[model samples]
Target: MANLCVAGGTGQVGRDVVRLALDAGHTVSVLSRHAPQAGSEKHHDGATYFAGDVTTGAGLEAAVAGADVVIDCLEGQFGKARKRFADGGVRLLEAADRAGVRKAVVLSIINCDRSTAAYYASKSAKERVYQESPLETVAVRATQFHSLPVAVFQAGAGVGLIPVFKGARFQPISPLDAAAAVLEAALEPGSSEDHRIRTVGGPEVLGMREMAVMWKSVTGARGRVVELPLPGAMGRYLRAGLNLAPGHAWGRETFVSWLEKRRETL
Candidate 1:
Protein backbone atom coordinates (compact mmCIF):
# COMPACT_ATOMS: atom_id res chain seq x y z
CA MET A 1 0.00 0.00 0.00
CA ALA A 2 1.26 3.42 -1.00
CA ASN A 3 0.36 6.91 0.13
CA LEU A 4 -2.37 8.10 -2.22
CA CYS A 5 -4.16 11.29 -3.13
CA VAL A 6 -7.70 10.87 -4.33
CA ALA A 7 -9.32 13.79 -6.13
CA GLY A 8 -13.09 13.99 -5.99
CA GLY A 9 -12.85 11.55 -3.10
CA THR A 10 -16.25 12.50 -1.70
CA GLY A 11 -18.12 11.21 -4.76
CA GLN A 12 -19.83 7.82 -4.86
CA VAL A 13 -17.03 6.13 -6.75
CA GLY A 14 -14.26 8.10 -5.11
CA ARG A 15 -15.46 7.24 -1.65
CA ASP A 16 -15.29 3.55 -2.43
CA VAL A 17 -11.77 3.86 -3.77
CA VAL A 18 -10.74 5.53 -0.56
CA ARG A 19 -12.38 2.79 1.47
CA LEU A 20 -10.76 -0.02 -0.49
CA ALA A 21 -7.35 1.58 -0.23
CA LEU A 22 -7.68 2.10 3.49
CA ASP A 23 -8.97 -1.40 4.03
CA ALA A 24 -5.75 -2.59 2.45
CA GLY A 25 -3.78 -0.47 4.94
CA HIS A 26 -2.82 2.22 2.45
CA THR A 27 -2.63 5.83 3.59
CA VAL A 28 -5.01 8.19 1.80
CA SER A 29 -5.39 11.92 1.25
CA VAL A 30 -8.58 13.17 -0.32
CA LEU A 31 -8.86 16.34 -2.35
CA SER A 32 -12.16 18.14 -2.08
CA ARG A 33 -13.48 21.73 -2.01
CA HIS A 34 -13.49 21.36 1.71
CA ALA A 35 -12.37 18.40 3.79
CA PRO A 36 -14.80 15.54 3.48
CA GLN A 37 -17.46 15.53 6.21
CA ALA A 38 -16.19 14.11 9.48
CA GLY A 39 -18.33 11.02 9.19
CA SER A 40 -16.84 10.04 5.82
CA GLU A 41 -13.30 10.75 6.94
CA LYS A 42 -13.60 8.95 10.23
CA HIS A 43 -14.46 5.65 8.58
CA HIS A 44 -11.12 5.34 6.78
CA ASP A 45 -8.40 4.39 9.21
CA GLY A 46 -5.45 5.97 7.42
CA ALA A 47 -7.21 8.95 5.89
CA THR A 48 -6.16 12.60 5.59
CA TYR A 49 -8.28 15.35 4.11
CA PHE A 50 -6.98 18.00 1.74
CA ALA A 51 -8.99 21.09 0.99
CA GLY A 52 -8.30 22.25 -2.53
CA ASP A 53 -9.97 23.21 -5.79
CA VAL A 54 -9.04 21.04 -8.76
CA THR A 55 -10.51 23.70 -11.08
CA THR A 56 -7.77 26.05 -10.00
CA GLY A 57 -4.24 25.49 -8.79
CA ALA A 58 -5.12 26.73 -5.35
CA GLY A 59 -3.83 24.41 -2.63
CA LEU A 60 -3.51 21.64 -5.21
CA GLU A 61 0.27 21.47 -5.17
CA ALA A 62 0.34 21.17 -1.43
CA ALA A 63 -2.42 18.58 -1.42
CA VAL A 64 -0.60 16.18 -3.74
CA ALA A 65 2.90 16.77 -2.44
CA GLY A 66 4.71 13.48 -1.76
CA ALA A 67 1.67 11.37 -2.54
CA ASP A 68 2.29 8.12 -4.40
CA VAL A 69 -0.71 8.31 -6.72
CA VAL A 70 -3.55 10.68 -7.65
CA ILE A 71 -6.94 9.40 -8.74
CA ASP A 72 -9.46 11.64 -10.45
CA CYS A 73 -13.16 10.68 -10.22
CA LEU A 74 -14.57 14.07 -11.06
CA GLU A 75 -17.87 14.74 -12.83
CA GLY A 76 -17.84 17.78 -15.03
CA GLN A 77 -20.18 20.66 -14.15
CA PHE A 78 -23.81 20.92 -15.40
CA GLY A 79 -23.92 23.92 -17.75
CA LYS A 80 -21.08 23.29 -20.18
CA ALA A 81 -19.89 21.24 -17.27
CA ARG A 82 -17.49 19.43 -19.49
CA LYS A 83 -15.40 22.48 -20.20
CA ARG A 84 -15.13 23.35 -16.56
CA PHE A 85 -14.23 19.78 -15.71
CA ALA A 86 -11.74 19.51 -18.51
CA ASP A 87 -10.02 22.72 -17.46
CA GLY A 88 -9.91 21.70 -13.85
CA GLY A 89 -8.54 18.35 -14.90
CA VAL A 90 -5.76 20.03 -16.83
CA ARG A 91 -4.84 22.06 -13.81
CA LEU A 92 -4.59 18.98 -11.67
CA LEU A 93 -2.63 17.09 -14.30
CA GLU A 94 -0.20 19.95 -14.71
CA ALA A 95 0.32 20.06 -11.00
CA ALA A 96 0.91 16.35 -10.95
CA ASP A 97 3.31 16.66 -13.83
CA ARG A 98 5.26 19.47 -12.18
CA ALA A 99 5.36 17.67 -8.88
CA GLY A 100 6.88 14.63 -10.59
CA VAL A 101 4.24 12.20 -9.45
CA ARG A 102 4.81 8.95 -11.33
CA LYS A 103 1.38 7.38 -11.42
CA ALA A 104 -2.18 8.71 -11.87
CA VAL A 105 -5.57 7.15 -12.46
CA VAL A 106 -8.42 8.97 -14.14
CA LEU A 107 -11.95 7.68 -14.54
CA SER A 108 -13.54 8.23 -17.94
CA ILE A 109 -16.88 7.16 -19.42
CA ILE A 110 -17.70 4.56 -22.07
CA ASN A 111 -19.86 6.58 -24.49
CA CYS A 112 -17.28 9.30 -24.82
CA ASP A 113 -17.39 9.47 -28.58
CA ARG A 114 -17.24 13.24 -28.97
CA SER A 115 -19.36 13.38 -32.11
CA THR A 116 -22.17 11.65 -30.26
CA ALA A 117 -22.66 14.17 -27.45
CA ALA A 118 -21.26 17.35 -25.94
CA TYR A 119 -20.69 15.51 -22.68
CA TYR A 120 -18.55 12.96 -24.46
CA ALA A 121 -16.46 15.72 -25.98
CA SER A 122 -15.46 16.94 -22.56
CA LYS A 123 -14.95 13.46 -21.26
CA SER A 124 -12.69 12.70 -24.17
CA ALA A 125 -10.63 15.78 -23.43
CA LYS A 126 -10.33 15.14 -19.73
CA GLU A 127 -9.10 11.64 -20.50
CA ARG A 128 -6.32 13.18 -22.55
CA VAL A 129 -4.66 14.33 -19.35
CA TYR A 130 -3.65 10.76 -18.60
CA GLN A 131 -2.93 9.54 -22.13
CA GLU A 132 -0.82 12.54 -23.12
CA SER A 133 1.12 12.91 -19.91
CA PRO A 134 4.69 11.70 -19.62
CA LEU A 135 3.86 10.21 -16.23
CA GLU A 136 3.00 6.55 -15.86
CA THR A 137 -0.79 6.49 -15.72
CA VAL A 138 -3.97 4.48 -15.82
CA ALA A 139 -7.10 5.56 -17.65
CA VAL A 140 -10.17 3.42 -17.09
CA ARG A 141 -13.35 4.06 -19.07
CA ALA A 142 -16.46 2.58 -17.53
CA THR A 143 -20.13 2.39 -18.45
CA GLN A 144 -22.58 4.21 -16.22
CA PHE A 145 -22.65 3.09 -12.61
CA HIS A 146 -25.43 0.52 -12.15
CA SER A 147 -27.39 2.06 -9.28
CA LEU A 148 -27.17 5.69 -10.36
CA PRO A 149 -29.55 5.31 -13.26
CA VAL A 150 -32.27 7.34 -11.55
CA ALA A 151 -30.00 10.38 -11.45
CA VAL A 152 -29.11 10.11 -15.17
CA PHE A 153 -32.49 11.01 -16.67
CA GLN A 154 -36.11 11.24 -15.73
CA ALA A 155 -39.10 9.28 -17.00
CA GLY A 156 -42.07 11.52 -17.47
CA ALA A 157 -44.89 9.10 -18.29
CA GLY A 158 -43.77 6.06 -16.33
CA VAL A 159 -42.54 4.74 -13.07
CA GLY A 160 -39.14 3.88 -14.58
CA LEU A 161 -37.40 6.21 -17.00
CA ILE A 162 -35.64 4.39 -19.82
CA PRO A 163 -33.86 6.80 -22.10
CA VAL A 164 -33.40 5.14 -25.49
CA PHE A 165 -32.21 5.93 -28.94
CA LYS A 166 -32.22 3.30 -31.73
CA GLY A 167 -32.10 0.63 -29.04
CA ALA A 168 -29.13 1.69 -26.98
CA ARG A 169 -27.67 -1.01 -24.75
CA PHE A 170 -25.62 -0.80 -21.54
CA GLN A 171 -23.75 -3.06 -19.16
CA PRO A 172 -23.92 -0.87 -16.10
CA ILE A 173 -21.51 -1.89 -13.33
CA SER A 174 -21.56 -0.94 -9.65
CA PRO A 175 -19.67 1.92 -8.05
CA LEU A 176 -17.72 -0.65 -6.04
CA ASP A 177 -16.61 -2.48 -9.14
CA ALA A 178 -15.56 0.72 -10.81
CA ALA A 179 -13.73 1.82 -7.70
CA ALA A 180 -11.90 -1.48 -7.47
CA ALA A 181 -10.91 -1.34 -11.13
CA VAL A 182 -9.46 2.13 -10.73
CA LEU A 183 -7.46 1.07 -7.70
CA GLU A 184 -6.08 -1.93 -9.55
CA ALA A 185 -5.13 0.29 -12.44
CA ALA A 186 -3.32 2.61 -10.09
CA LEU A 187 -1.34 -0.21 -8.50
CA GLU A 188 -0.38 -1.78 -11.84
CA PRO A 189 -0.48 1.63 -13.53
CA GLY A 190 -1.38 1.38 -17.21
CA SER A 191 0.22 3.71 -19.68
CA SER A 192 -0.27 4.77 -23.29
CA GLU A 193 2.55 2.29 -23.73
CA ASP A 194 -0.13 -0.34 -23.32
CA HIS A 195 -3.27 -0.30 -25.45
CA ARG A 196 -5.86 1.99 -23.87
CA ILE A 197 -8.03 -0.30 -21.74
CA ARG A 198 -11.74 0.30 -21.25
CA THR A 199 -13.24 -1.34 -18.15
CA VAL A 200 -16.59 -1.56 -19.97
CA GLY A 201 -19.89 -2.99 -18.72
CA GLY A 202 -20.58 -6.56 -17.67
CA PRO A 203 -21.98 -9.97 -18.72
CA GLU A 204 -25.47 -8.92 -19.87
CA VAL A 205 -26.74 -6.36 -22.35
CA LEU A 206 -29.80 -4.51 -21.08
CA GLY A 207 -31.62 -1.51 -22.41
CA MET A 208 -32.10 1.51 -20.21
CA ARG A 209 -35.74 0.57 -19.73
CA GLU A 210 -34.89 -2.94 -18.65
CA MET A 211 -32.45 -1.51 -16.15
CA ALA A 212 -35.22 0.65 -14.75
CA VAL A 213 -37.52 -2.32 -14.31
CA MET A 214 -34.80 -4.32 -12.57
CA TRP A 215 -34.13 -1.48 -10.16
CA LYS A 216 -37.84 -1.04 -9.54
CA SER A 217 -38.34 -4.74 -8.86
CA VAL A 218 -35.38 -5.00 -6.52
CA THR A 219 -36.22 -1.89 -4.55
CA GLY A 220 -39.93 -2.50 -5.01
CA ALA A 221 -40.18 1.12 -6.02
CA ARG A 222 -43.51 2.21 -7.46
CA GLY A 223 -41.88 3.81 -10.47
CA ARG A 224 -43.16 2.80 -13.91
CA VAL A 225 -40.59 2.20 -16.62
CA VAL A 226 -40.90 4.29 -19.79
CA GLU A 227 -38.85 4.40 -22.97
CA LEU A 228 -37.95 7.92 -23.99
CA PRO A 229 -36.84 9.25 -27.40
CA LEU A 230 -33.23 9.73 -28.38
CA PRO A 231 -32.25 13.24 -29.49
CA GLY A 232 -30.37 12.85 -32.79
CA ALA A 233 -28.33 10.58 -35.06
CA MET A 234 -25.40 10.86 -32.71
CA GLY A 235 -27.60 9.80 -29.85
CA ARG A 236 -28.89 6.96 -32.00
CA TYR A 237 -25.42 5.68 -32.79
CA LEU A 238 -24.45 5.88 -29.15
CA ARG A 239 -27.66 4.23 -28.05
CA ALA A 240 -27.10 1.42 -30.49
CA GLY A 241 -23.44 0.80 -29.67
CA LEU A 242 -22.27 2.93 -26.80
CA ASN A 243 -22.07 1.13 -23.47
CA LEU A 244 -21.35 -2.49 -24.32
CA ALA A 245 -18.07 -4.36 -24.61
CA PRO A 246 -18.16 -7.24 -27.09
CA GLY A 247 -16.83 -9.80 -24.62
CA HIS A 248 -14.17 -10.27 -21.94
CA ALA A 249 -15.51 -7.25 -20.08
CA TRP A 250 -13.94 -7.20 -16.60
CA GLY A 251 -17.17 -6.28 -14.87
CA ARG A 252 -17.93 -7.90 -11.53
CA GLU A 253 -21.24 -6.29 -10.62
CA THR A 254 -24.76 -6.65 -12.05
CA PHE A 255 -27.79 -4.41 -11.70
CA VAL A 256 -29.60 -6.94 -9.53
CA SER A 257 -26.75 -7.29 -7.07
CA TRP A 258 -26.19 -3.56 -7.11
CA LEU A 259 -29.84 -3.01 -6.18
CA GLU A 260 -29.73 -5.61 -3.43
CA LYS A 261 -26.75 -3.88 -1.89
CA ARG A 262 -28.43 -0.50 -2.05
CA ARG A 263 -31.29 -2.03 -0.09
CA GLU A 264 -29.20 -1.87 3.06
CA THR A 265 -28.63 1.87 2.61
CA LEU A 266 -32.30 2.55 1.91
Candidate 2:
Protein backbone atom coordinates (compact mmCIF):
# COMPACT_ATOMS: atom_id res chain seq x y z
CA MET A 1 0.00 0.00 0.00
CA ALA A 2 1.15 3.52 -0.82
CA ASN A 3 1.54 6.28 1.73
CA LEU A 4 -1.04 8.64 0.29
CA CYS A 5 -1.79 12.20 1.28
CA VAL A 6 -5.10 13.74 0.32
CA ALA A 7 -5.23 17.50 0.26
CA GLY A 8 -8.64 19.01 1.01
CA GLY A 9 -9.69 15.59 2.28
CA THR A 10 -12.62 16.92 4.30
CA GLY A 11 -14.66 18.02 1.28
CA GLN A 12 -17.26 15.94 -0.54
CA VAL A 13 -15.12 14.14 -3.10
CA GLY A 14 -12.04 14.33 -0.90
CA ARG A 15 -13.84 12.54 1.91
CA ASP A 16 -14.59 9.63 -0.38
CA VAL A 17 -10.97 9.52 -1.55
CA VAL A 18 -9.83 9.32 2.05
CA ARG A 19 -12.27 6.54 2.83
CA LEU A 20 -11.39 4.54 -0.25
CA ALA A 21 -7.67 4.97 0.33
CA LEU A 22 -8.02 3.75 3.90
CA ASP A 23 -10.15 0.82 2.79
CA ALA A 24 -7.36 -0.16 0.41
CA GLY A 25 -4.91 -0.38 3.35
CA HIS A 26 -2.98 2.74 2.44
CA THR A 27 -1.47 4.99 5.09
CA VAL A 28 -3.68 8.03 4.52
CA SER A 29 -3.10 11.58 5.65
CA VAL A 30 -5.65 14.35 5.15
CA LEU A 31 -4.62 17.99 4.81
CA SER A 32 -7.04 20.88 5.06
CA ARG A 33 -7.12 24.44 6.33
CA HIS A 34 -8.79 23.27 9.54
CA ALA A 35 -8.34 20.00 11.42
CA PRO A 36 -11.29 17.68 11.05
CA GLN A 37 -13.46 17.33 14.13
CA ALA A 38 -13.57 13.86 15.61
CA GLY A 39 -16.80 11.92 14.99
CA SER A 40 -17.72 14.31 12.17
CA GLU A 41 -18.95 12.85 8.91
CA LYS A 42 -15.78 14.00 7.18
CA HIS A 43 -13.46 12.41 9.70
CA HIS A 44 -12.28 8.83 9.24
CA ASP A 45 -10.70 6.80 12.02
CA GLY A 46 -7.89 5.23 10.02
CA ALA A 47 -6.62 8.40 8.38
CA THR A 48 -4.53 11.20 9.85
CA TYR A 49 -5.61 14.85 9.54
CA PHE A 50 -3.34 17.87 9.25
CA ALA A 51 -4.48 21.47 9.49
CA GLY A 52 -2.57 23.29 6.78
CA ASP A 53 -3.27 26.16 4.39
CA VAL A 54 -2.03 25.36 0.88
CA THR A 55 -2.30 28.96 -0.32
CA THR A 56 0.36 30.18 2.10
CA GLY A 57 2.49 27.03 2.55
CA ALA A 58 1.71 26.95 6.23
CA GLY A 59 2.13 23.48 7.76
CA LEU A 60 2.45 21.99 4.28
CA GLU A 61 5.80 20.36 4.94
CA ALA A 62 4.46 18.46 7.93
CA ALA A 63 1.32 17.45 6.05
CA VAL A 64 3.14 16.01 3.05
CA ALA A 65 6.22 14.64 4.83
CA GLY A 66 6.93 10.90 4.47
CA ALA A 67 4.18 10.43 1.88
CA ASP A 68 4.74 8.70 -1.43
CA VAL A 69 1.86 10.34 -3.30
CA VAL A 70 -0.37 13.38 -2.88
CA ILE A 71 -3.87 13.53 -4.29
CA ASP A 72 -4.80 17.19 -4.58
CA CYS A 73 -8.53 17.81 -4.17
CA LEU A 74 -8.20 21.43 -3.10
CA GLU A 75 -11.13 23.74 -3.84
CA GLY A 76 -11.46 27.53 -3.88
CA GLN A 77 -14.41 29.86 -3.64
CA PHE A 78 -15.91 32.02 -6.39
CA GLY A 79 -14.05 35.18 -7.51
CA LYS A 80 -11.07 34.03 -5.42
CA ALA A 81 -10.63 30.74 -7.24
CA ARG A 82 -7.99 31.93 -9.67
CA LYS A 83 -5.52 33.14 -7.07
CA ARG A 84 -6.28 30.38 -4.64
CA PHE A 85 -5.83 27.54 -7.10
CA ALA A 86 -2.84 28.98 -8.89
CA ASP A 87 -0.95 29.93 -5.74
CA GLY A 88 -2.05 26.97 -3.69
CA GLY A 89 -1.13 24.48 -6.39
CA VAL A 90 2.39 25.85 -6.57
CA ARG A 91 2.85 25.61 -2.82
CA LEU A 92 1.40 22.11 -2.65
CA LEU A 93 3.59 20.83 -5.48
CA GLU A 94 6.69 22.38 -3.94
CA ALA A 95 5.94 20.78 -0.61
CA ALA A 96 5.37 17.40 -2.21
CA ASP A 97 8.59 17.60 -4.15
CA ARG A 98 10.55 18.56 -1.07
CA ALA A 99 9.05 15.62 0.78
CA GLY A 100 10.44 13.29 -1.94
CA VAL A 101 6.96 12.32 -3.08
CA ARG A 102 7.11 10.06 -6.13
CA LYS A 103 3.79 10.99 -7.71
CA ALA A 104 0.95 13.52 -7.53
CA VAL A 105 -2.66 13.30 -8.63
CA VAL A 106 -5.05 16.18 -9.13
CA LEU A 107 -8.84 16.18 -9.45
CA SER A 108 -9.95 18.57 -12.16
CA ILE A 109 -12.87 19.39 -14.45
CA ILE A 110 -13.27 18.07 -17.97
CA ASN A 111 -12.72 20.64 -20.74
CA CYS A 112 -11.78 23.27 -18.20
CA ASP A 113 -9.56 25.12 -20.64
CA ARG A 114 -12.32 25.60 -23.23
CA SER A 115 -14.22 28.06 -21.08
CA THR A 116 -13.14 31.45 -19.75
CA ALA A 117 -15.30 31.10 -16.65
CA ALA A 118 -13.43 31.96 -13.47
CA TYR A 119 -13.85 28.48 -11.99
CA TYR A 120 -12.71 26.65 -15.13
CA ALA A 121 -9.82 29.04 -15.56
CA SER A 122 -8.68 28.26 -12.04
CA LYS A 123 -8.85 24.52 -12.68
CA SER A 124 -6.86 24.89 -15.89
CA ALA A 125 -4.21 26.85 -14.08
CA LYS A 126 -3.89 24.19 -11.38
CA GLU A 127 -3.52 21.49 -14.01
CA ARG A 128 -0.62 23.40 -15.53
CA VAL A 129 1.04 23.64 -12.14
CA TYR A 130 0.96 19.86 -11.71
CA GLN A 131 2.05 19.08 -15.28
CA GLU A 132 5.04 21.36 -14.94
CA SER A 133 6.23 19.83 -11.69
CA PRO A 134 9.15 17.37 -11.63
CA LEU A 135 7.11 14.65 -9.95
CA GLU A 136 4.99 12.32 -12.05
CA THR A 137 1.47 13.76 -12.14
CA VAL A 138 -1.85 12.31 -13.16
CA ALA A 139 -4.63 14.80 -13.80
CA VAL A 140 -8.07 13.21 -13.53
CA ARG A 141 -10.53 15.49 -15.33
CA ALA A 142 -14.04 14.35 -14.46
CA THR A 143 -17.51 15.58 -15.40
CA GLN A 144 -19.85 17.15 -12.87
CA PHE A 145 -20.53 15.06 -9.77
CA HIS A 146 -24.04 13.71 -9.02
CA SER A 147 -24.15 16.02 -6.02
CA LEU A 148 -23.87 19.15 -8.19
CA PRO A 149 -27.30 18.97 -9.84
CA VAL A 150 -28.84 17.80 -6.59
CA ALA A 151 -27.50 20.92 -4.90
CA VAL A 152 -28.75 23.07 -7.73
CA PHE A 153 -32.23 21.63 -7.52
CA GLN A 154 -32.27 21.83 -3.73
CA ALA A 155 -31.31 25.49 -3.83
CA GLY A 156 -34.14 26.32 -6.23
CA ALA A 157 -36.65 24.11 -4.40
CA GLY A 158 -37.17 26.72 -1.73
CA VAL A 159 -38.53 29.20 -4.30
CA GLY A 160 -40.94 26.67 -5.87
CA LEU A 161 -39.04 26.58 -9.21
CA ILE A 162 -36.00 24.69 -10.45
CA PRO A 163 -34.18 26.38 -13.30
CA VAL A 164 -33.00 24.10 -16.06
CA PHE A 165 -30.72 25.41 -18.74
CA LYS A 166 -32.57 25.17 -22.02
CA GLY A 167 -29.88 23.39 -24.04
CA ALA A 168 -27.66 21.96 -21.33
CA ARG A 169 -26.97 18.29 -20.73
CA PHE A 170 -24.85 16.57 -18.09
CA GLN A 171 -22.86 13.35 -17.65
CA PRO A 172 -22.52 13.49 -13.90
CA ILE A 173 -20.32 10.87 -12.21
CA SER A 174 -20.51 9.70 -8.62
CA PRO A 175 -17.77 10.82 -6.23
CA LEU A 176 -17.08 7.19 -5.34
CA ASP A 177 -16.26 6.43 -8.97
CA ALA A 178 -14.10 9.51 -9.27
CA ALA A 179 -12.25 8.58 -6.09
CA ALA A 180 -11.67 5.07 -7.42
CA ALA A 181 -10.12 6.55 -10.53
CA VAL A 182 -7.82 8.68 -8.41
CA LEU A 183 -6.75 5.66 -6.39
CA GLU A 184 -6.02 3.71 -9.56
CA ALA A 185 -3.93 6.52 -10.90
CA ALA A 186 -1.99 6.75 -7.67
CA LEU A 187 -1.21 3.05 -7.77
CA GLU A 188 -0.38 2.82 -11.48
CA PRO A 189 3.30 2.23 -12.18
CA GLY A 190 4.78 4.89 -14.43
CA SER A 191 7.93 6.84 -15.19
CA SER A 192 8.84 9.54 -12.73
CA GLU A 193 9.04 12.04 -15.61
CA ASP A 194 5.57 11.40 -16.92
CA HIS A 195 2.50 13.61 -16.68
CA ARG A 196 -0.78 12.06 -17.77
CA ILE A 197 -4.38 13.27 -18.13
CA ARG A 198 -7.48 11.11 -17.89
CA THR A 199 -11.18 11.89 -18.26
CA VAL A 200 -14.10 10.05 -16.68
CA GLY A 201 -17.87 10.54 -16.89
CA GLY A 202 -21.18 9.07 -15.81
CA PRO A 203 -22.80 6.11 -17.55
CA GLU A 204 -25.39 8.23 -19.36
CA VAL A 205 -25.78 11.76 -20.55
CA LEU A 206 -29.19 13.30 -19.82
CA GLY A 207 -30.71 16.64 -20.60
CA MET A 208 -31.07 19.24 -17.85
CA ARG A 209 -34.85 18.97 -17.82
CA GLU A 210 -34.74 15.20 -17.77
CA MET A 211 -32.42 15.13 -14.78
CA ALA A 212 -34.46 17.74 -12.89
CA VAL A 213 -37.66 15.77 -13.47
CA MET A 214 -36.00 12.56 -12.28
CA TRP A 215 -34.68 14.31 -9.19
CA LYS A 216 -38.13 15.64 -8.33
CA SER A 217 -39.72 12.20 -8.73
CA VAL A 218 -37.12 10.40 -6.64
CA THR A 219 -36.85 12.96 -3.86
CA GLY A 220 -40.53 13.94 -3.79
CA ALA A 221 -39.43 17.57 -3.90
CA ARG A 222 -42.24 19.97 -4.86
CA GLY A 223 -40.96 22.25 -7.59
CA ARG A 224 -41.85 23.02 -11.19
CA VAL A 225 -39.04 22.65 -13.73
CA VAL A 226 -38.52 26.01 -15.37
CA GLU A 227 -36.49 26.09 -18.57
CA LEU A 228 -34.31 29.20 -18.72
CA PRO A 229 -32.14 30.49 -21.51
CA LEU A 230 -28.51 30.14 -20.45
CA PRO A 231 -26.81 33.06 -22.18
CA GLY A 232 -23.10 34.03 -22.49
CA ALA A 233 -19.97 31.96 -22.99
CA MET A 234 -20.84 29.52 -20.24
CA GLY A 235 -24.18 28.85 -21.92
CA ARG A 236 -22.43 28.24 -25.21
CA TYR A 237 -19.93 26.00 -23.46
CA LEU A 238 -22.64 23.83 -21.91
CA ARG A 239 -24.73 23.74 -25.09
CA ALA A 240 -21.68 22.47 -26.96
CA GLY A 241 -21.32 19.66 -24.42
CA LEU A 242 -17.79 20.68 -23.52
CA ASN A 243 -18.48 19.57 -19.97
CA LEU A 244 -19.01 15.95 -21.03
CA ALA A 245 -16.74 13.03 -22.00
CA PRO A 246 -18.97 10.35 -23.44
CA GLY A 247 -16.01 8.38 -24.80
CA HIS A 248 -14.61 8.07 -21.28
CA ALA A 249 -17.80 7.09 -19.53
CA TRP A 250 -15.99 5.14 -16.85
CA GLY A 251 -18.47 5.58 -14.02
CA ARG A 252 -21.07 2.90 -13.43
CA GLU A 253 -23.54 4.84 -11.30
CA THR A 254 -26.38 6.64 -13.05
CA PHE A 255 -27.89 9.81 -11.68
CA VAL A 256 -31.10 8.03 -10.76
CA SER A 257 -29.21 5.23 -9.04
CA TRP A 258 -27.25 7.73 -7.00
CA LEU A 259 -30.47 9.52 -6.08
CA GLU A 260 -32.13 6.28 -5.07
CA LYS A 261 -29.19 5.37 -2.83
CA ARG A 262 -29.26 8.84 -1.30
CA ARG A 263 -33.00 8.60 -0.70
CA GLU A 264 -32.47 5.39 1.24
CA THR A 265 -29.96 7.19 3.47
CA LEU A 266 -32.51 9.93 4.16
Best by lDDT: 2
What is candidate 1's lDDT per residue for 1-266, written digit by digit as tens? 68788998888789899999999888888887877566654345567878888767788998788888889987774785566887888788788878877788888877575354667777777777667766676678887666546554334325444443346567777788888888888877445563255565665678777766776676666654555566774556555676666574667777778668767553
Error of 2 at 253 (Å): 1.5
- Show model 2 residue runs off by greater than 4 Å: 264-266
Which pairs of residues collide in model 1? 77-81, 159-223, 159-224, 160-224, 160-225, 168-239
TM-scores vs. true structure, each candidate:
0.86, 0.95
- lDDT at residue 9 of model 2 (Cα atoms): 96
> Which residues of candidate 1, in runs, are more than 4 Å off?
41-43, 152-154, 157-166, 189-195, 264-266
lDDT (0-100) at residue 241 of candidate 2? 94
